[model samples]
Target: MNFELDEELINYKEKVRAFALKEFTEEVARTHDIEEKYPNELRMKALHEGIIDFMNPWKTMIGIEEMCRVDPGLGISATVPYFGAEVLMLHGSDYLRENYLAKVISGEKMMGLGVTEPGGGSDVAGLKTVATKNGNEYVVNGSKMFITNGTIADFFVTLVRTSKPDDPAKRHRGLSVMVVERAFEGFSSNKLTGKLGVRATNTGELIFTNMKVPEKNLIGDEGKGFYYIMEFFNISRIFVAAQSIGIAQGVLDRTTDFLKKLEASGEYVGEERKFKLAEIATRVEASRLLMYKAASFLFNYKPNPTITSMAKGYASETASFAAETAMEITGQTGISTDLERFFRDSKIMEIWEGTSEVEKIVISRMILKGEKNE
Candidate 1:
């Protein structure tokens, strides 16, 4: 098996890294992070510069890793405009694709995914959002919490319950995915501020009060939204794994430089800190390998969900571990520098796409079902 990245991917990785280093400057990153503002300009710039290429999943993965290595907040903000585009690409109708997805791809519009409800964190099936059929359209009512690009997106690929389940045990049934437009009369959003991490990416509560969505906006078939979302999660988790590895690598880079500088200044660095750095580097490398394996399976259309979960779960934990351990190594200097921002940003990696606990559950269940990692 080939372990090295192809020459093209290597060059693309460098291109993305250079773009991020140049554009995601310390001032720009700090401004967005401290003000809790979305970097719309960087988003547009990334789009124009071909920094966000979804057509090539490998490029997309590498770009996320490289950009986020520079700054998670701005990096994620730059890439997430097309967050839920996969659902549309795989399951949306031609009309939905041409009208909505095309615009989003061309950067004429932005989109978000609406799944997590205020009352439901990882319990996607427990979401209370309802879309009652009314002739040719569905009237939606409910709210989604902590949605990325919530307040700014031109549209949302929203999951809503279409009918009551025949059996309470099958709450996941009768759910559907719909493209809800921001201009819908009953749609509103409240921007959420003071977030713990990734604050450069917009987060908000999406509320729907009798919001009307056309029947044509339904993605795939009715009663199939749960499966569609699950499939999307399988794909998204790989990108999240990339994001995690990026954070971990970034932390390692900073910590190593710090130690080198200290040693250059004739300071005696302890063995404990050296060991921590070594552990961080090892975890980062392992996370990348897992992510690459998961990506290879997924992008080849022979997806192994167990491996995907393992990659995401392990990488996310590694990001958090690397950041925290860097803090321990750097002590006061860590808390005072951008490493502090990295620490704050590393947290949400374990929470979003799927929580580390959620990933563990997926991994165990798949293993019990006789799924084996290749």
Candidate 2:
């Protein structure tokens, strides 16, 4: 019932905000967006400065919100170097942990999660990527698309099918998770360009042709990657909500500043503009509450997937709404300012993690099933 941050978290929030303001400068964000480049240098800077403390989920969540509020591209780029760490932390073998997780945590290596196949889209269970076990190794073939950190990640926690299900209805049954190294032969990536938003984040296509992954690289049990990834998505969607909330708040900040400046210079401030700002602020507050409620359930280990879906779906919608309203309120300046970039950045929040449509399905199914635990 309590919505207030404790002293420690309050201090941490300020620290993260300060770090984002200082490092993710407007010029740096603008340059990265223009070039469609990854912010590897900024990532390294944040890592070295201890801004990315994975041991504390609260810090990570607050850090994401604060950083994204400053600039979505740089903020997401800075925080997602170890994007698949939770999978490793929960299910990886000791060898995988010592070799892969350690290196990534130390900032010596970058990693990503690969679940979306080229043709799969959001049909996670329908993915065609296959990994046939060959005695001591698994030979993987197929390709992944729209993968974050695809071109630069040293390795990927990839999901692939190991066998066909005995029951025709259970297409999700034979999936498995594994650590696939970039150094392995027959693995290649092609960078994707000209994204509409969050251009500072690295994205590319991953192709696997007879790529060899050691048998020991398998995470948890075979034929459980579907469940593992679903679990990961449930947790990750909270961060996506945080990102959405941040973008919404960022829109609020910029619009307020713009309106204030207009008023200061003797421009008329209309009730319509005030109403739009009020609506955005209310949604931002609601999104924060929903995000916190979802995160509370999830981080505490008693997750309600329904609440998570609601939070992500609503927050992402709010982000897009806020951005659009910001444009209308800012008028001509929106055409030539960071508001355009913010508008672009707001869109991907709904697409990545889970589309707003996907989230609606999750929410609807759960609600209709009499599972209104939220």
Worst 10 residues of 2 by lDDT: 365-374
- Pairs with steric clashes in candidate 2: none
Residue pairs in candidate 1 whose N, alpha carbon or C atoms collide under 3 angstroms: none
The global C-alpha lDDT for each of the candidates, from Candidate 1 onward, is 0.95, 0.92
- Candidates' TM-scores? 0.99, 0.99
By lDDT, who's the top model here? 1
lDDT of 2 by residue, 1-374 (tens): 57799999999899889989898878999999999999899988898888888888878888899898999999899999989889999999999999999999999999999999877878998998999999999999999999999999999999999999878899999999999999999999999998999999999999999999999999999999999999999989999998889889988999999999999999998999999999999999999999999988988999999999999999999999999999999999886888899999999988999899999999999989989675
Q: Once superposed on the true structure, which residue ranges of model 1 sit more than 4 Å away at CA?
A: none
Sequence-dependent TM-score of model 2: 0.99
lDDT of candidate model 1 versus the reference: 0.95
> lDDT per residue, candidate 1, 1-374, as tens digits?
78999999999999999999999999999999999999999989999998888899999999999988999999999989998999999999999999999999999999999999999999999999999999999999999999999999999999999999889999999999999999999999999998998989999999999998989999999999999999999999999999899999999999999999999999989999999999999999999999999999999999999999999999999999999999999998999999999999999999999999999999999889998787
Candidate 1 to truth, TM: 0.99
